[model samples]
Target: MGVVSVKKSVVLLSLGHACVDVYQGAVAALVPFFIAERAYSHAAVAGVVLAASLLSSVAQPLFGAVTDRRALPWLLPVSTIVGGVGIALSGVSGSYAVTLAFVAVSGIGVAAYHPESARVARIASRGSHTAMSWFSLGGNVGFALAPLLVTAVVATGGLRFTPLLVLPALAGSVLCLPVLRGLAASAANGSVAAQAKRPDDRGSFVKLSIAVVGRSITFVGLSTFIAVYAQERVGGGVLAGTIALFTLYVGGAVGTILGGRLANRWDRVTVVRYAYLVAVVAVAGVVFVPGPAFYLFVAATSAGLYVPFSLQVTLGQDYLPSRVGTASGITLGLTITIGGLASPLIGGLADATSLRVALAPLIAMPVLSWLMFRTLPEPAVMGADGSDGRQPAPDVGHRGAVAVGVDAPGQVGDGDARQRS
Candidate 1:
């Protein structure tokens, strides 16, 4: 009534952007730009980015599992420190080998993020489903905003200013120190408490996992390589083509907000399933569309398909009540890594045939994603809290551990159980 009570939502969004800034600018979007600026081959760019995705994705699940048992409040600041350093160094890298190393180290920082951030949202919010929708929207926004930031700097300051570009990230990192300290202190004092225990959904999880992995081949293919695609295949200036990638981001931004709204009002699965149908059309259209007219439809594909990302993350968070950290990490990390891995193969196909010819697999991904999601039970039918169509929260009283705040694992140290183990 007095002031809008969206503190939790704000915090979630900020964290999302923090995660986004760490990767999109320095890793994903940077790959091709670096190739052009540094004069490297397309395959080499794919390989370096592959290193990034693999490390980040693999690390997320492992770290998420760790956070489940122990809360470490300092991870936020520490991760920012590592991420900032890696990014700053990357901007200055003179050789492809060194750049690859920089991206790999930066990947570690990004890898540390999802598990803790997702877990925090679950443990902190009363409505994890709705919260995750907004939570994921934050990340979506950040990804959308990255190119603008890159364009602004490169436009005004030129590529030389890139190395010093770590300043903003460093500032963001330093600013989080107080926030992380408070989280740690609260966890240490036992001020935060565990969420209600929930049943795990083995079968639904498997199905969703397959769906996301399938979808990722398309999502990553588009996200990672779209800018380059425009330059080479779309018959536009590099700057124009670069801006074209922003169309996808524009679509994605809308999709994130729209996806959240859909999750709040309807079935998350319905929204996600529909996104695939749009993606299939978009991928095909993008491949065949000629000249400037093609950009408009590509933008449509981006908007229609990207909106469901939040839905996917929310579903995963809801499904794994006891393991939000691990689930978030895997959902994001593994799925996108699949795309990252497959992109090189796509690039090779383009090398042999053509860029348009290599992208055929992208159309298939959504179909597979949709089919896999359909087999799982509807979230509402299974008493899902807007998660994977899985079991509901277990009785809270039965669990032995008591977690506090968002950092139930080590990001925030949980208090020692008052009762004996």
Candidate 2:
């Protein structure tokens, strides 16, 4: 595909991504409304969040496996519609059980959308992590927009107008149709899968998963408590906390974009390694440093943690080339979900001890994750054939080593980085 064509495809898919994830974000925003309107207990509201998390994060692989088994581009728009509709209907329901059900429905849509979307994005990206970053940035922006959108809807018309929230999803679903057609057309032609021959690097993927778990735990913990941590650390109350939290999340979004650009010039694995190392320093600074310096480290740490986020999804797709959908599901779903699951424990620790002590564990996580990344062997297909198995740069000639195992059949490199014998 041409550059413009690829760009258009990525934009469309990213829109669908944003639309679907907005529901996930909406769930969080909706919790306060539930408290106000339904008088739901803290545990009950948590149940709602838990329901969304379980269905959305856990079932992703199943949806992905199905997509891998067959072409299902249709799921993109269908899931988008379902996701938004679920969220729209959530607040209108009077029964707590019914509300939980609606949120879970939205969560299911979120689950179904991710794997196939990531697969198509990888194809459209043609191996550009920078392009993939744009796709990921869509979801980040969506999550950020959720609160604003939800608040506006509720403030203007109250909970009754919540159904209006479905408009974005409706628009996104319609827009994604053409993008789906483009993806289907590309699949009919020779695809990225056809261009590069790769073995299933399951061993490496498992190691990557371990590393993701570490980052996820640290990320979600910080995300859950950064505002609170800011309030306590700076003694600046809610506004200061809000600003600190915003800085952290915005830094992450910016880092996701920057990492993609860096990947164009250097090895993705190298970029990931350096990002984690930076995270180690930043996280330590967050714990040890006080005052304004703490907020600076929060932003620095967020950037470091997020730089590799999109890269890992692409890497997972490369690792399990034959099961791209499944790879996307795991990398995008379970790892982060499991980390989110750990946040309560982190909170409990904070309850039992000081917030600083609870955060102390976070400082060590990046160091461990950085070491785990060290165990990741660069993908054999990375530079084989002079392409990073992604779309080649416009100026780069397609002259170099053919995919290493194209002619000879054997496994790719293992974690040790030794070439296949």
Candidate 3:
């Protein structure tokens, strides 16, 4: 049993997410530049993004089902090839039709990654916040770095090479193969089943799934449009344009770390409520900030934004300790469709009312999220480990208790800090 732990599993998954985010989000930042280079319309770029989201958000559940039923170590790698080829093709795409087609293809690669990876994280992490935090950070860092990396590539080698840049990550994401093989080893040896199990593993985990979708809608809104909002609504410079990304993700990274510690100290629900309230405040501040201090307010608006992102994923694992793959797909998969489906409408609203109009959901979504969370049964996972009156997970020991913290059988020393949780 000294082999894989949830912590190790999540760390690998986190790294994978970083690679995928760069693959999927590079064009989001590059769209305006693409339009300038190709004379495309704002609406046309939005359409391309919309196409990617449709593939990503809608197709995820199907992929999630595949991950659960099958054990293809090459799934992530194969998808990366498709996505990388599609992205590289985007710059060279001759027509709008071709561009959208390539974008959608890349989105498919982007879409398949999360559910599969999240399932891995959940299994490896053993059902703990630390595991979820690592996953969140991996994805956050990946998404956050997309614009920077893509822009640098575009600047140095030009847009044509943009697709080529994703090749490394595209290739590297396949590392999951070895990891999956290791997991099979553990399962075959009975270490996994013996070490871990959760009560909710056999159930639907539906409520947790709903909460995940709600948070994703808001998270994607900021990730997808905060830059445009920064430039247009807040009047910030292009550099300051990532205000939401910077404030939300970096702060959420910090908050998630703290949340892990706090979950150990306070109730998980308490920390979640506080995090959601902060999101409500942050979104509102962005929506109705007064003149002048737009930068200051946008930064503040981003505060606490990603906390729920980390929280919801962790919470889902806690809710359905065994169904991490479903929870992962539920959290990230439905997002491809539900929140993604809202993009064109959101863009259309931004077009009609003003760029600031896009900020509408960014602000209101959290309040609605809070309302949804309120209806949820109090999370028992917070007091897990025999800490809060509940029995230790029936057959699962600390391994089962620490659901998201499992390290996997082979990669024992990746030096990931989130695992210390």
Q: What TM-score would every model get versus the actual structure?
A: 0.84, 0.80, 0.80
Kindly list the per-residue Cα lDDT of model 2 for residues 203-229, writing each as its tens digit.
999988878878877776666566667
- Tell me how far candidate 1 lies from the true structure as C-alpha RMSD in angstroms: 4.8
Indicate the worst ten consecutive residues by lDDT in candidate 2.
Answer: 394-403
Quote the lDDT for 391 in model 3.
Answer: 18
> Which number leads on lDDT?
2
Write one digit per residue (lDDT tens) for candidate 3, span 1-421.
1344545556666777677767655657666566557876546667777777786776776775454444334666677666767777877755789888988888888777776566555445644565667776776676667777766777666667666666656545665655655555554443222222447732325755665566666766665666666666556566656544455445555665666666656656567667777777767776667454655555444445555566665565456554444555666665444665666666677667775666676676667666666666544532323454321122221223222222342222212111111
Question: Candidate 1, which segments miss by more than 4 Å at Cα?
Answer: 1-19, 154-160, 174-196, 232-234, 380-402, 405-421
**lDDT score for residue 334 of model 2:** 62
Question: What stretches of model 3 exceed 4 Å from their correct place?
Answer: 1-10, 192-207, 233-237, 242-249, 290-292, 296-303, 318-323, 335-337, 381-421
Better of 1 and 3 by TM-score: 1
Q: Rank the candidates by TM-score, best first.
A: 1, 3, 2
Candidate 2: residue 177 lDDT (0-100):
79
User: How do the residues 280-309 of candidate 1 rate in per-residue lDDT, one tens digit apiece?
Assistant: 787888877767866886787776666667
Report the candidate with higher TM-score, 1 versus 2.
Answer: 1
TM-score of 1: 0.84
Q: In model 1, what is the error at residue 38, expressed in angstroms?
A: 2.4
